[model samples]
Target: MTAKEIFDSTIKEIEPLYGNDEARSIAFSLLEHIGIMKTAVLAHQPMETDTSILQKWIERLKKYEPLQYILGETSFYKRTFRVNSSVLIPRPETEELMEWIIRDFGSVEEDFSEKPAVTIMDIGTGSACIAVTLAKEIAESEVFAMDISEEALKIAKENALRNNANISFLKQDILHDFIFQTPLDIVVSNPPYVTENEKSAMQANVLNYEPHLALFVPNEKPQLFYQRIATFAKKYLKPTGVCYLELNANLAHQTAELFDKEGFTEIIIKKDLSGNNRMLRAAL
Candidate 1:
């Protein structure tokens, strides 16, 4: 069959669940995964490929499974990272959080050899996207990533190795008390901020396919992770260090207040491309 035929058929099968625009996007991505480019598909090029694998993907999509999980990978900050049911898929908003940190610390002209190594820790580091990206993008950065799930940490380690980013992996539950041997220059996290009440508003693709432990908190304590992060920042972050977090837009102000109560004098809430208050920067 032709690439266009496969693309159109896949879209038709899943359009009801994802809508036309999203279905088209997903179809294009699936085709690209099989070495079929969008241009070739659109140009009506005939392609020879395995049909059974494509059929399996279509079946998963019909069940509201995420395409990233089906493909076993996704692109984050221009780098590919492996993902599965064990980890939450990295979102674009998280990229903005990485950018904010990079903008503050990254320099192309400066000699990193003359400066001390920038110490960074990523809490609840699912696929290690944030940790690995920071280690690769910033020169002379020593990175550490922690996650509660053993499976998630395994995937995170593979991503770190694949990207050739040096990171120390820790299996930790941030809700519990923990200690670090050295002071940190930066602490960053995109921890579980979505409350149980918000689950109804999310799409099936996310709710069904992604790891719930990394995506939600009790509705009564929506700021649970934020509170712990603020407390950890107070204890571990250096006097000149900063903390970066990806916020739940609906509770941005409330989350910021946690940092303020922790005596973080400087707090900045930055909006994502959608103009939602989605990123926070706090400093001691």
Candidate 2:
């Protein structure tokens, strides 16, 4: 088949499940990634592909597997992130959170003679996207990331290396062993906030393919991650430290209130590009 033929087939196969526009975008993205042009999709060109790999991708798409998983990577903050079942796929909203951090404390650099170096910790760091991005963008900041999953940490570490972002990764479960002796200049996270009751409304591509451990919490205790992170911030964050978190859009108020009750000052609930209250910032 020609590039057009494969592209058409890919979109046609995925459209009913994902949507016409989104399916077309995915099809085009895959083709572009493999350097397959619509005109050259056919085996007429030496570069054209008619491999079984195409069929396998179609089969995976039918199963509601994310295109990122199929491609084994996704773009976040204009950087490529390796993703799989072990780690939550990086999202655009998370990129906005990273951008906010970069904007507020680019380099977090001090004169060194007058003040101490900046220190940052990312709790529940999944693929290390936040940790790596901060390390790469804030050269003078010391970055540390903690995640519960060993498998996830493997991918996170590799992502840090691939991006050449020097970050320290620790296999510590935030729920139980959360501890930091050093005063933190900043603490940030995009923790599990999707409750079990909300799962029914989510798409299968997310519900089936994404790691639930990193995406969800029990229905009865929806704000557990926020509460825990808030407590952690209260303990470790310096009086001048800032805390940035990606909150569940629907529960933005509750998440921000957690910080408020924790005595964090200047608590701010910020909306994403989509106008959803998706980010929260506060200071100790």
Model 2, global lDDT: 0.86
Among all candidates shown, the one with the greatest lDDT: 1
Q: TM-score for all predictions?
A: 0.95, 0.91
**Where in model 2 is the C-alpha error above 4 Å?**
37-48, 107-116
Runs in model 1 lying further than 4 Å from the true structure: 108-110
Candidate 2 residue-wise lDDT, 1-284, digit = tens: 56667777778888998899898888877887677865565454444565478778889988988989998998887688999999999888988898888888755453344456678999988899999889877747789899999999999999999998888889987788455777899999999999988988999889998999999999899998888888888889888999999999999998877888899999999999999999999998
Clashes of each: 0, 6
| Candidate 2 local Cα displacement, residue 3, angstroms | 2.3
- Pairs clashing in candidate 1? none
